[model samples]
Target: MPPPARRPVGTVTRGTTNPNRLRRVDRWIGYALGGLLRSAAGSPVVVDLGYGASPVTVLELADRLRGVREDVRVVGVEIDPERVERGRPLADPPWVDFARGGFEVPLPAGLGADARPLVVRAFNVLRQYDEVEVWPAWQRVVDRLAPGGSLVEGTCDELGRLAAWVDVRRGEDGLATPRTLTISLRLAGLETPSVVAERLPKALIHRNVPGERVHTVLGALDRAWERAAPLASFGARQRFVATARSLREDGWPVVDGPARWRLGELSLDWAAVAPS
Candidate 1:
């Protein structure tokens, strides 16, 4: 089947994006899925779903993924045709392309409807949407994922200082669910880990109520960060690593080791911090 004729995917976004604004998530994508992308059978397709305002993220993604696999193909999709037009001039074909589309995860022209992508990065796109709309959006995008593919959804500050995202992948039942949630902090002049709460993806953002699981995890994290205060003398990196280790020691089900923790990132199975 072909995509809807004269039909576009989803709504137009806020169209606000900055250079390097999505670096942390991009870096995480590299660390988390680069191997899978590298070993894909052929040119692996990646969608920068709702890459707002600029093509920088798309271009940067291609450049970064090319570091893992030369044949990495990236398509920047935006419902705003103007935004797509803005990016088209900047993108290099074959490896990087731009299309006016949305959650349907439309592949560029010349690809079949079955051309599911190996990865879809939709950052800062859902924050403006009603919380109830998130899962439906995820379902739409997830339905387009190639085998072993992923849909990374999240929000970040304008400068990319703090980032939080849910890594959605196929669960044991072969349905998509939030698998891992990762929080990335800049670590420079950082005081507490809870600051990332402000950047949590909308799906989990409001769910940070006092009795909710996310709130519970955050409260514990803040306390552990304070307890690790003595390590501040060694530098923020050490303090963060100690705090992350503390999280694991306290049975938080941390999925990443000290290496990523030292980089001021902590990833855990989303079930551990999911909303009630």
Candidate 2:
């Protein structure tokens, strides 16, 4: 006999999705965290939570990660059963699948009980929830992660031009911790790196006000970006690289280097910009 299905944790989101809207984070998943997938025991499972009205982004995620690990499997998880049905026809099995779920992160039954996700990218999922709900939601997702797995949660603009996310991983104490805050921009038309403040994850969004650590960080990024304007004549990418360097030089604890900065992205220890 079939077992009764357990209810999925979390709630229905706006489900607003667009093609390529998640490219920046997907690049990060493929490039920066690709090693995790490669070292995983078996074919790694990645969860695209709250993949909204469409499954397009989850499909895109699968295609991108396949370049890193050919056996990578992606599950588009949505609390909306209708959206789940909408995505099933698009599923290619083993490579891509759609399931009705929320932060609980359900996988296909065939994957077996040991198949926890190596990465859970929950972009824009928590935006609709109160800031107070962020940590709890993160905990729920982290609890479902495979060892050494990570949960990337945050928000991005509709066009995918500006974005910010927190990479949450389990700590030594077996609790979730937001280890780093990453901001990715479309350098071609970028004005200032601080523009990401508007797209920060739910946890830090309201903390952008004065006196908060995140606010200070954004202010510093803006100043550094302004100081890099002369380099803009070379290219936005170059200018952004300079901006990233300046942040590190000024003791902002920037992570990565010019190689990543060239991608219009910057990352900092979560401690550096965590709410006061």
lDDT of each: 0.88, 0.91
Per-prediction CA RMSD (Å): 1.8, 1.1
Q: What is the C-alpha local distance difference test score of candidate 1?
A: 0.88
Per residue, candidate 1 scores C-alpha lDDT tens digits across 122-194 of 9999998999999889888888899889999999999999999999987667666899899999997998789
> Which parts of model 2 are misplaced by more than 4 Å?
1-3
| lDDT (10s digit) by residue, model 2, range 1-276 | 889988888888888889999999999988779889999888999999999999899899999999999999899999999999999999988789988888888899878877899999999989999989988889989999999999999899999999999999998988889999999998888877788888999999999999999999999999999999999889998899999999999999998899989999899999998988
Alpha-carbon TM-score of each model against the true structure: 0.96, 0.97
In model 1, the runs with Cα more than 4 Å from the true position are 1-6, 172-174
Model 1 pairs whose backbones collide? none
